[model samples]
Target: MASDFDDPGYDYAVSVAGRAVRTMAEQRIPPMPTNFAIWFQYYAGSHNNLRNAIDLLIDHNRPFDVSTNQDLFETCIAPEVSAVVVETSERLQA
Candidate 1:
């Protein structure tokens, strides 16, 4: 029997992460945590709005400047981060 660590899903996730990092380097986006989270979600195809926003920006040839990255993080990743924080706090309190 194969170990859980050998699951194909793990490989897929690694592939997505690699693509995210490569795309970030190509776009000159910083390898900051928030930026990586945003790009990871984009490459994972799990967040449509985030993907659409990024696609629009790329389509328009917009630079991923600090402001643009900040906007993307706020719009795309902050809500998920807030939810995780809230869940963790509740779990700890429980």
Candidate 2:
């Protein structure tokens, strides 16, 4: 059985973050933590569930591409995420 902490994504995330930092340095982008975070989040796209879904597909030997990308977005990603424009709004309302 696979544990959440052992997810292959941790390695992928580290690699991407390192690349982000290096790329910024090479291009002379500001070395601020905020800038690094912005680039990292852009790397993840707007969808919060995207990385997890792709990880699942890759782990199962499923083909992930443009066609399947739309399928996953519509069928899984959109539905799974909350509709809140501001997630904290719920807390404020309560």
Candidate 3:
């Protein structure tokens, strides 16, 4: 749980949904609305396995370099596609 997640440019919604979309690609899952819903639900779950890693990082109170942002996203959120979920969640979070 390093402060890397606290980057000044960080957008929580973008990070979450961006990962979902990247997960879709990595899993070869189509980016349909229904599928997106499933991915987002899992990301948002209180006991989410993926997010748990993030929680653990925070619990450790570690510090990460800004250069590790992609690693943070892939390891905690999704993969290395992009950093903006510029569609639905973007609008919703806004």
Candidate 4:
């Protein structure tokens, strides 16, 4: 799969993700879609999560796209995410 994006191959990531999304779209199993939604929601924390989710979806024979995971971690947080308090305060003042 890694080789798909490099020499001897190109857009392998896109291909894999596309296949995963297609597989998931055609799934007929119960609790499977629910499980997928739950995991997908949890992985929305970062771009890596998106990539990992795509990988998981592909491994499970579903369709997905790596770009869908883009900018997953672009948010700027404080050293401990405590900066939210300050951000909220500033927003309120504005």
Candidate number with greatest TM-score: 1
**Which of the two, 2 or 3, has more TM-score?**
2
lDDT of 4 at 31: 31
Ranking by TM-score: 1, 2, 3, 4
Model 2 over residues 1-94: C-alpha lDDT tens digits?
A: 2222233487777976887687557645576654554345435454446556656766897754446645654654444333433444766788
Q: Model 3 over residues 1-82: C-alpha lDDT tens digits? A: 2222234344765776888798768656567664564455446453265456545655886433333333444554542123
> lDDT of each prediction vs. the true structure?
0.84, 0.54, 0.51, 0.40
Task: Please report, as a residue range, the 10-residue window in candidate 1 with the lowest summed lDDT.
Answer: 1-10
Query: Residue 28's C-alpha lDDT in candidate 2?
Result: 56
Cα lDDT tens digits, model 4, 10-88, are 4654454445455445553223433343333333333344456556666987533332322222322122134555666
TM-score between candidate 4 and the true structure: 0.22
Candidate 1 RMSD to the real structure:
5.7
lDDT of 2: 0.54
Q: What is the lDDT ranking, best to worst?
A: 1, 2, 3, 4
Q: After superposition, which runs of candidate 4 have C-alpha atoms over 4 Å from their true positions? A: 1-46, 64-89, 92-94
lDDT of 2 at 72: 56
For all the candidates, what are their Cα RMSDs to the real structure?
5.7, 10.5, 14.4, 12.8
lDDT for position 37 in model 4: 36
